[model samples]
Target: AERVWYPLWDAGLKLGHQVGTVAQLLDVGAENLETATSLLAARVVAASSADGEALVDDLAERALAQWKGRSRQNLDQLQGAVAERHARFGEVAFLLEPDIKEARGGLRDVHSLFWVEQATVPILREAESAGLAAAFEMLLEVRVELHRLTGQRADKLLLELQDDVAAALGLADADVLMAEVSAAGRTIAWTGEGAARRTLRASRRRGPMKALSGIRRREVAPGLVLDDGRLELTDDADLGDPLLVLRYAASAARHDAYLQRGSLERLADHAEPLPVPWPAEARGLFVDLLAAGPAAIPVIEDLDQVGLFVLLVPEWEPCRSRPQRNAYHRFTVDRHLMEAAAEASRLVGQVERPDLLLVGALFHDIGKGYPGDHTVVGVDLLTTIAARMGYEGDDVDLLVAMVEHHLLLPDVATRRDLDDNGTIRQVADAVGGTVLLGLLGALTEADSIATGPSAWSNWKAGLVRELVERTSHVLGGGDVGDVVGGSFPDAAQQALLDDGTFVVRGEGLELTVVAADRPGTFAKVAGVLALNGADVLGASAHSEHGRALSVFRVGSVLGGEPDWARIDEQVNRALAGRLAVAARLGDRSRTYRPIHLTARPARPTMTVDNVSSATATVLEVTCPDGVGVLYRITRAFAELDLDIVRAHVQTLGSDVIDAFYVRDQFGAKITDPEHLAEVELSVLRWVAVDF
Candidate 1:
């Protein structure tokens, strides 16, 4: 009874609508089992015919409800049935009726089908040329035969009706809408001229139609994309349909079977195309399949096709001339690619997807089997598989492009002599552009990791590091410098003690001393200060962080003629730029420990001039200066091998300084006054200056 209402509804709702576009709204049911089921198709009942404003508003309300599985006019299979109805009955008028599909599987809910059955009449209809009215009636009779005789009506009848529609248009069925219907569980083909093409006598499953095969999975590499075969695919390998079951079965079967040239030639001649009945004009491949075919490429899709043709044409298995000494290589060329693919699959952080990476890695080295660049060959393999897999055209191209630059990580990044970013960026730019540099970085790491521990070394790993860093810089841009700067901390300020040692400002600077740490190390250091008249405040010595660090914080004593300023300045200048010492000067500085400089009568006395101007003064006198005594005294002092601590001598208009500090027999300072006097008298007796 509901079947009585569909044509009426179609005529009422969309008879005058444009044929090229879907009406204002259409919804398909969401179901795991069936292909799209529920639907709501409508054109706006416009108040004033104002375009999408009215149309979209009408569609949105219904569509939102339909998407959420709440459309009142939803249909489980409206398109298939209505499409068939149109073909059988020609253009029938439809009326606005309650959605019968929402109630039952078929037009069986007759109680809800309370709508008038209206005949379709076009206001500006073209003339019926090839007995359109009679042909349509005949088509409906055939549909009834399938429903009554076979218990089902299928789309094949619609294909037959297409001929009649085209006949009305003065043409044979142009195959524009070829229909195949499954009736009584058998596929039937109908032509446009109200005729059947060929009865698919076998069930649709028995013919070339595919069985419901679940997608197959296989091991691939970290960054290399793999075909379902786990082979690292070349760019050409990114076939739209990787599972090209026929190709894979053939490819896999070849591995297990004996495929000689004679056999291959025979196989090529009979090799079937895509097992699925796809659109004839759909972007596809028809490989020569024969090794000796003159054509390298049967069909090309984007830049990736270059890669596919190469993999297809080559003999990929390796020979016996293997690298005997290498420990990691366990298989021939082809097997290695698969193994690398497996290794690459486990990696993350480097690629967008490990599976994609695995595919790429497998192809990266596969081309090495050929005569020229392996990258080129690998890319070709990728695109071929892409096409075979039925990937979108752009997707196929992207897959191949990845393969073309897979080897660049090693070939360009690592510099034996000098390293730079240009090569890294160039490789990355070629790869998934700047976006996938991180993935390339992961691929680079995987390449090294695949080489195994023994074979991969500092330089090799460094190449990986360079690629990682370059990618980071490119991706991070301005933020990379912040990463570098965060590693080292700023130097803490230190105080400059008058005792030529730096005192750390906040805490003592962890002194690192790499010099000879000897027995007199502490003593000798203390002695030098004592001799220089610097009183030590605090000192600590330790070894740490690959160097010996020593710190001494002391202040200048009243040493060297009580000239504190000169002493401190000289000490600072002496310590400044000393090889073993360095620190930042700050508010926390070292002060000299207090010590006195007392005048004592001795042979020679060392005095520090505190003032800016140079001045000389006598510190010790041997005996009294008498007539000619001064000359004798001076000569006596000179003869005694004594240096006048502050005697300024004018020699040929040049000032010669006779500076002194009295050193004993052991070259020590004469601090004792009595011993100093004895040493002074001895000097006087030697030159007859005084007693």
Candidate 2:
């Protein structure tokens, strides 16, 4: 109790001249009863005169009016508050283990619905009240039980506690409990969302606005219309046509138009069920909707909110808001599938079969809700879904294959050696042929990009592309040698003979340094560059014929143009071993937090490949990224007296995947297993450090 009111009391002491006593504090609160109500409701004053009591009553009446009345000022304030809350909790439904109080569709949503209902216009009062009430009651009960079982103030319904909570609530199983909770959350969330929409429309009606010229309308067939920025139905609309729903959805998606709430409600309550073995037009429109890319997300969300999507695809229920229970996935299973399909739409021109790509993306995770291997189970489910959509036998076979191996590209690209002929051939055999391979490649990119930022990096993309090209080469009966030959540019010799080159490119400066090949060339270059107040974004290095060429992509750390002459002088001095690059870089590294040291385990991996190139041993490194990581890596190599022939550096979120081609002092490939192990251990240890 003291913790709750002490701040108010402390403020009173600061603001009031004589607020040391309790009675004096109450007097101060009574004089400013509105502030008191905001801080500690209703009990601010111990007793009051008749006139003071009447003043309090009047204040209460005004406060209620502000909350419940539809004045322009009140509605505007409400809108701002709603937007703030949406930003805070909009993605709560997708959490792996959601908080019962603060998460979207949780207890707060129920309260928000009540507040919105109180302020809604009369015509929109009972739009979905029954569902809202039921959801409120169920969530209140769960919240109470959750607090009791945990013997404290707990709101997150964790997986470990789900079974116990279910038993305590007299439920049959945890799944039943979770489904009930999810349903309640959705009900409250949808109702609140609908209320907010109505309030915004009401607020707009009072503002001075001009109607669009010529009664703008984009007709979807004969009845449905995008009229004046809202979806509507004409007088002669056919509610019995199942294809009308898909047509309207497709039109709204393609045109990026908002659907009217009333029209959505009518469709949800009265739309005709789609026939089994659905017609070609219906399936085509569904594909068109998916092909709209990210514009379709809003339409799909609106349909799901109004309960119309389930009527189109009943199999969607299991995947709705289903948690993936991993850090890598950012959305629920159904949302992830839709996002993947949307992402695939952006690459429609890249594939021979856009329709198949859309279908495969939508059904990629349909088996996640079931037990056993999801790939095999998803293949079975895809067969049924395809048949229901009236696909031909050959199309069904293709869809099954697509779903059965959706994870093939990313899994193989990241985990296997793409340089191996057997690896490329294995992918080709699994993919069947060149055409299917193309589709799989496109689908893989869409799926990975939609997974999360960390799931796909430039380096990973390059690896996947390489794998695909090599596989294509093999499939076309081309020699591996023909596909793997490219020469480094002669820029190094020119730069060595003169000054280095610095050019501004897209918000950063690209510095090209050329010098005689040495063990610590990269270290000196990176260190001297960092010492000049340059934040290195990326870099690449290559050395051949006793000459080294390096390019550093960097942005100014001090928000000004880099002093090119100073940078050039320092870099040269560092390369000549006159400057202590390591000590200088170490000093600068202390300003930034040691984020990588405390970061989640990166599962650092090292692979020494002797087959990729005959001349140099390729050391592929993957680990958590950090400030000055590249410097530490190159420094470690310099310490070991290993010359880096080439280096490729890439970062995806916090993870860094790099490859370095190196040789011993004698210019021989480090083939001995014991020596390779020592090198791998050294690199991994340096990578694990923050500086």
Candidate 3:
């Protein structure tokens, strides 16, 4: 094929005609056959005929006119078409691994914008077109390289292939490559959306009701006006005023209106820089903008796109479009920060200083764009950032503490034994007081919810809440033991224990098992729940005298409500040793093996912590999640003759971090080094079992 086309391509190039690859030719042919045919005819005639110059010009004009006519005819249907396209391939601009061809901000969107510009009057200005073209070329180059590397027709930039693609493009790493992709994709998507909106407005202005809709305007603030549903500066507005930008952004966000592209460009070109140690009014406006919640996202996005946001916060430049590169994060660093701030806005009523909360949430992950531990770096960054934003000493310190401890609550709640007194005291000491603790608590939730779905769950939230309550008690001058001790066997569970009878009850998604305190009690219940298709999200165990109480928070594998009756009956049989739980689980695993194990699983890890709790040994296990994982791990503990005091199970993406508070058969912490090694080995062996 190359031999046949090489001479023709050379002749066409010599004739001063542009040439593209076979794929480009196929794309043009697919989009419009007449245009493709006309271009081909023009190239062939110019290359083969002596009088082909004049004929080529006519064919080119014909193709241009055809495109212009099509654009004019389809102008009314453009918005719906864009929406349909977005519906098919999602509209998020910051997908960790994105499709370069068909995604919302991908090449297709750029094409749509090009078509829009070919209408009766161009929708995009010259500068906008040039920028969009550059972004389009960047994405196209990446897509081509991706196809070359994979040796297949590929578009989606998968995580596994990112590093190789980056190297092929002479980029530093996958993060750098993805950051470029993100920036380009965002440019295209933003421009395409603006063009579509302008097209709709232009079409409306030319309709029969044009006279009635003639440029409705309202002055919304000192220098800002709402013109035809868009926010823009008034003719007399002062661009020299440093506070104007913040006021404009805050007003646009609060009113939930679009920022006019012309106004945005003017501001980007002429707006003054905000003074360091911003004035109280400027700070207020910034907080008000963040207080707009989800509505602030698009407004801030527009500012970032126009290079206005970075001008306000110079430290924000590195974070723009920075990829998080993990399954746990749903957005880039900057976007996640904005989303976290937005989520925090909903809980403003819960915090003492909403301003501090809003600012803290926005800057919690700012240091992620830098080196070193994000928490430690974040503290140093916020110390200066907050001060520049007009915060006083106390406020600055509070914000710094917020950034430093943003992950503390969730980390402790999910991975540590919350019932441990040392755990509660450590959190209290770190938090310092109720005021800072409250800010961190709200920030933790907002940060987790913004991170991703798997980052926050009911079980995890419950644990954090329990931790916060215990920490708050200590900060409020109450005894730590009062909060952490002797509260498990509440009146109801104690009455069941007082009767000294085996009782198993299942209600909705909760299962409670009370029986004689034994080594295998927790393991037996976990196995029964797994066998019954109940996913154990969390569980806790407590024993008073010779009786034990085990409570499980569960969900069905197939979703909806759990079958409590069947689960209850199975628990009875398993606890009584009548059911073969292990054999049954093995058979189930063999019948319904996971299809997602194609990738090698991470090596399982076990950590024995005797320092966190004074009364029990804490075993933290990290491994890939599976159906019978909990059963296997707990079964190991039971076989080791360890008493299960409490268990905290948290599933993060494909992995689970399960922390167990265990004791020796004599109800003491396991302190022997050899015994600890044996415990770790047994758990690892059980976790690696196929069943």
Candidate 4:
């Protein structure tokens, strides 16, 4: 029904004893010619067969055995050998070793093929001839396709390898597996040496007979074998031209790629450069990029999203790096700075939305370009360049803000000592608002990782905690209570209970608040009740029919208020002049009719309704008004196979929202919103949350 095969090739030495009978017949001059030919062929087949077999007397004769045993013990380094030359060949045909270490049972034989294909897909391709590689423009095409396949993981080496055939063709760590196929369909000995030689031949693509078809020789390297064993071209013109330079560089990259894996010291004497901002023009373009702002980004050329990244790093101190004291530092301040930036990008790649955030982390310290007043000098320079390049508005704003706030992480980390509030205030000040702490937090996490673990400690987590608190407060959660409270007039418009209104004339924070009246009239204020002990917000009023009423709404004021104390005093004086003002110096209160907002739960039971199912690591989350963070608790249950029976999410602002839900998997209504909140808070701390 089924067949098996084995192979053994030992460079034509100590041949199996079957050949012994053939040799004797030849020596005695009594060979039967045709008979001898058949006999020799049978011997070779038997040698490769997995085991010796005998004709069975009965169908169920389990007593018969076909045995084969290992005669030598040099197969220990087999996998390393195969992986080392993975880039050289494809469709490797080899017998399985008696034992497989990493996988279990059939996993070794079946699963390995799939795994090998996957790992090498990013770094290697089906390359038999350079002609095919060139015809497909395999490097560029593969990269685009690979990036699509990887989706969000595009920055990782795995994703980058999809387009890296030029380099992947050279990664010796991967290989295609091949199995010896024959007509006999019987067992055979393993030919480990044959596999190795075939690997070398496949790596070269074509033998001497077909070398000209694809891998033609052309000398490109200087001081190396010119017009000798390897490929080469004599004209210096190929070196100077941009298009030609890219081609040759790609060629070199691929060539070195192979040589590097073979453990060859250096593949070439020159560097392979991608098409990008000319190193010679870097100074002016850097300045231009700083200026062009957001518009400049849309017009970027030569550089892809991955390569456009640049990092700004600190000057190295001799005493600071204890490990590298012995080696002379070839990377000076400028070069080391570049390295730091690169390191930072590598770290940021692992975070969510890293593409957007890493750009700021890279360019944040670029303001050091000027001799003095980096903030002003850099800002001015950036705006000028951006204006020149047709960049303005939000693009310019984003860049300027990042560069301006770049020092926040290091400044806090290296500070003498900073309390939680101080750290939070600093973060809020840099980001323009506490609500943006999530974005800033992502940036901070990337920066810390970019610099490596030695750069931070548990003490640094306190800084993150402060920022989270402020951010959560801004997100309509946490115990922010009222950052800047304002006054509401007593009696809703002759008790009409219809107009939702609030009066906050302090600190430019005018908002329209509306919510049904409940038990906690004072405590349930959603946002900005008081800040720095002053009501820096406006008044709000809301009312429905007499049966259901609450207060929430704020006066809309542009550019916000300035100096709550000054505004409060001015308001008091104006109120005293206008009406009977009983406003005391300290105690203040407001009563207003209330309005209600209906709550609806999200439902996706039918297949048509539930199309997308995303499996993501929970990063950051929130809950609806008067509701705690049910999202986090449900997500935790999801992790533990706890199904959410019902869930609802309500968006209140651009970066803020809240969710509520029931998880039947736990079989109980989560009553303690505070406990849920605490769980969310602890989870936020345990993981530097992202989304």
Candidate 5:
């Protein structure tokens, strides 16, 4: 009810009145009150009146007339109110859990439409109004049911409560309930946004004579023209041309302008269907639209709202407004695809086939809406889509492969050992060649970025990049050692190893430790860094003769930069057995807890892989990420008399995946079954200490 009375009170106070009573405010009439306030008061009075409906109707008409009399002055305030409301409540339509009352596309958006309509001219078409009304009713029903079930006024449709809400409403399950909610919210949000833009544009227009004289129309393409800053079709443009829709969309994106709603409606109603196995020109235009980078997203969204986008790719309908019921994805299936394509456009220069990369990114996750495995289903779906878009046999196959292997890079990079020859060979075989590898590599980065903030990180990017380089070497017929040999003891590190002296160098977030090769050297450095408030993002170790060199990439656990001078001194003292590294780390672990502790911690697991690497046993440990995880794990290996040749440390959200290439005291892989089992048990025991 605040939406109704707050504006009225604010307006009355502006008119130099206390507004102590509703009667005083209503008696002020439309002339003295702001248009937005008058409209809000009209709705409240009309809803509350029983027998005075006719009187309320007269009040509403007077408010509309007054608003029209000073449309320009009123429009700015109304638009500002709408923007402020959106700021308070987010505008995303397909959140895993949605706010039913305040979120964009929620009941408040419907109310915003009503306010905008009363303040300006009619913005929604008759059909659009009907759709918006239905959407509002659905959201209202859900909100009412939520209130009844919870016995309290709760607006957010929480994930855990969705099932109970769905059952009360006689829906099949939570997914079904959420999908319907997404559809309704998207409709209301899109309609509301369009209406707001149109009203704002109308308010900015000049008087008829000045407007006609100053109107600027510049042709952007064959059918599209920039008419008064909006992309629209010229009077002589052809409507029946199949490729015209793509051309218009591309021009709109390239010009960075909003597509005129009237022109969009005309195109949706009259444009012919693109022929199957589309001609080169039509395909080129479609690609060009996708290649417009971030600008293409809003243009594609506008086309989707009018049903024009679906006409080009019918497979896109199922994905539209479909919620991804997980914390990892920040957008709906269709929106994520669009975002991924937009991100991929920026990385086009990195690949040999930018066209395939762009198209592949757009369709990579298209099968999430289907029932089967998304990757498998996506491969099938893209096969048909690629062929229809006029790709040749090999191009179609490559696109299909891209969807099938879209997640391959990130999954392998984060979860497997990149130092292993077998791992590199496996990836090279799956990717087939460098060209597809390049495409998938870029797609992996784009897709992860689009998923959510937690999905992509510099550590993950490094792993993927390393994997791609190693796989590229193998695919190009180079020996695996050619790539692996170049790693570790690189020119800078080899110089540190050759020094054969204790050296602790600290620069920014990177720390390098060179010391005499000894048991627990790596563990001491890791524990010292952790105690110094340095979160070890990644670390690598190498040794030649009696000297060992370790390079660590770290970030501050408490934010800002780490105290490098203190860390450097502490590392030297710990290596000299004077700093009590383990005891200090244990104390810090008791005091410091990870900020993002999940309800269900991942069950710790360890795998001893001997076949992946020829010389060292690849021991991979996965556990919930906590304080000093790498320190504790390496300490266990040192206790077992194992020497860590190399290590890859990565943190993915609440979990950490650490792969260590280790060897026995004699520099031999731990091949005995009992020894392997002991290694797994020891690491798991140490990792569990922090948990």
Candidate 6:
């Protein structure tokens, strides 16, 4: 303790003498010292010969004076420091456990205001200052309580400790404590960020003529004008316009610009509230803001900073700046909603009611802050809000349905059997019609993208699109056969076939095989390609009227160019029963092991579908992709006397998703449950064994 006091005393004395006054000693830590857990408590004793009490009193006055006449450079230095701290914190609202001191909009932001005030910087005006001071006090109390509970200088409000801290603070529970903390954090962060913006604005060269010369003001909407890239009020606008704020927000979003701070302050002061059932223009503007895609994020942030978002959607308060204590999210509930809306905006053209999709996206997860399953809670909350916004009858129902079943598409696509007629019918019936199906499909993508990268993949996207298309057919009152019979090769791959008679395009050896359809066409072609030292990466096979057009994308297994002439001869021999694919592949298997096994293994699944095609049973085999896996599966089909009609093979990273459409003898769909089970079992055995 004495060692600590000696250094502080020496530092204070040196700083006091250098400033040439005892009153110039500034103590930034004193204001919150009583609540500080880690700061050492010490007293500086003076010599018995000196006037100790008088010297202390003089030091306080000089310290206050040093803050009063700060130079321009000093103010800039403070701004830079705050900006550096802001960068260090990054976006923390959605961190699984947030640091209560250094996180954005946390105690540090509140402390920055004290520094700003101490420097006599007038960046924060009267209203912002009042708000910030109250927020600072709240955060300071939380920090003090946290330190007391932990018995250390702990600042991270981790999930496990939140309940304990809440109990110590006399709060009802952790949720209530978190709500209060989030509110304070949002206020402090928003205020500090506004001040930082203003400081940058203040540092710019100031001259009305020079500002005007850069970019003149232009009217963007009825009551809004773009004043040098920032939005502001036009001279002819009515100050009391109920829709004025929303209109300006929409215009700013559309142009990828921001609302001027002065304009925001003016709007906050005078903008009138919309009627109970919001007018057409207000609702339209809300949709427009969402439709602006990524451009809307900054505009929404500006609205939130200026308190306009809460005014527009009063229910937004509990969620604003709220931390999501989960690994899946990368943003707070409010930020995630904005990002979802932006992503939905990109897919708006896909839906019939883009406006409803936009609104639904904006409020999809509004119930995360409340208790219960978010989907159920969100449906009730968004329905009420939609009703208040003047949506009625089918429109109100549509919004409710959208919220309730937002996760329907992705869930069904990934987990359920998409090739079953019953599966497609069930989804179609649940979502009502094509309109809702389209909207739900778009919302699913938007929501997943906002959740995080791990929540989506190309394979997932392909699955969802297939579900949507099949469901659309059902809703259109078409039989399963229409959907099944119409399924064709991917348009891009079909184009690749028509461009040349027998072309091999890709570096990975794409071979276009055009031949008369036979009993083991796919097996022969695949085995020939394999024997020629060409490893099949993927293949697409299509057949019509005794003729087959197949494309195989292959890489070199032997690290050399494939012998095309030998491949042609072997394919013919295999078709003629003069070549054995199974025996040759079995020999090759002994030399190499599977290379692309997942770091975390998953059980291989073989799905047999009879409803996806009119003439063939669809077999989708998903497994760890490795050398000769395709050859083994094709050989198994040939041994089962199954004729391959079409095959779509795709490799996604370490896994292979290969769909083989096959017909039994007499070219009929295999509907017998026992036979289908046998086929699945056979494929599983082939996929499981090495050879």
* Highest lDDT against the true fold, candidate: 3
For all predicted structures, in order, the TM-scores are: 0.27, 0.67, 0.83, 0.26, 0.79, 0.61
Best-matching candidate per TM-score: 3
Better of 1 and 5 by TM-score: 5
Q: Under the 3 Å rule for N, CA and C atoms, how many clashes does model 3 have?
A: 0
Q: Relative to the unseen true structure, what is the C-alpha lDDT of residue 357 in candidate 1, on a scale of 0 to 100? A: 60
lDDT of 3: 0.82
Q: Write the per-residue lDDT of candidate 3 for residues 1-691, one digit (tens) a residue.
A: 4655678666543222335644454456447533443353344432456555655565555655655555545554555666777778764357766788888889878766665665557788665778888888889989999888987778888878888989998999888898999889888988887887788788777876488574587899988998776898887889888888889999999998989888888888898778888999999999999999999998999999988998888789989998876666778899999999999999999889999999999999999989899889888888888888889988998999998888889978877777679999889989999999989889989999998987887777887889998999999999998888666767887888788889998877888899988888898889888777787877888887888999888865587667778877888888888989899999888886643321234479998888788988889998887778899999999889999888878776567789999999899999999999999999999999986
Clash totals for all candidate models: 96, 0, 0, 77, 0, 4
Residue 691 Cα positional deviation in candidate 4, in Å, after optimal superposition: 52
Pairs in steric clash, model 5: none
Deviation in angstroms for 411 in model 2?
A: 9.5
Kindly provide the TM-score of model 1 when superposed on the true structure, using C-alpha atoms.
0.27
Extract clashing residue pairs from model 6. Answer: 22-59, 23-62, 23-63, 24-62
> For model 5, how does the per-residue alpha-carbon lDDT over 265-332 read when each residue is reduced to its tens digit?
88888977789889999888888988998999989998898888888999999998887776657888
For each candidate, what is the lDDT? 0.34, 0.71, 0.82, 0.31, 0.81, 0.71
TM-score of decoy 5 = 0.79
For TM-score, candidate 5 versus 6, the one ahead is 5
Q: Which regions of candidate 1 fall more than 4 Å away from where they truly are?
A: 1-330, 348-350, 353-355, 380-385, 388-394, 410-435, 457-466, 476-480, 483-691
Better of 2 and 5 by lDDT: 5
Q: Which 10 consecutive residues of model 5 have the lowest summed lDDT? A: 13-22
Greater-lDDT candidate between 2 and 6: 6
lDDT agreement of model 5 with the native:
0.81
Ranking by TM-score: 3, 5, 2, 6, 1, 4
lDDT of 2 by residue, 1-691 (tens): 4544678666443232232333444444444423333322232363357776665555555544544543454446545665676577554456545677777777776655544555555424466777778877887888788888876667787766777888988998766676677767777776676677666656555555324333576675688887655677766777777887888898888878767777777777778768989899989999999999998887888788777887888788778766564456667687788999999998889888889889888888889877788898898888888988989877888888888878887766765545445556677778877777787888888888888776786767887888788878877887665654343435443445344343222223767777787778887777777677665654555565666677666665577767777778887788777998767766777875434321143688888877555667778787766566777777778878888766666554456677777788888888999988888778878767654
Order the numbered candidates by lDDT, best leading: 3, 5, 6, 2, 1, 4
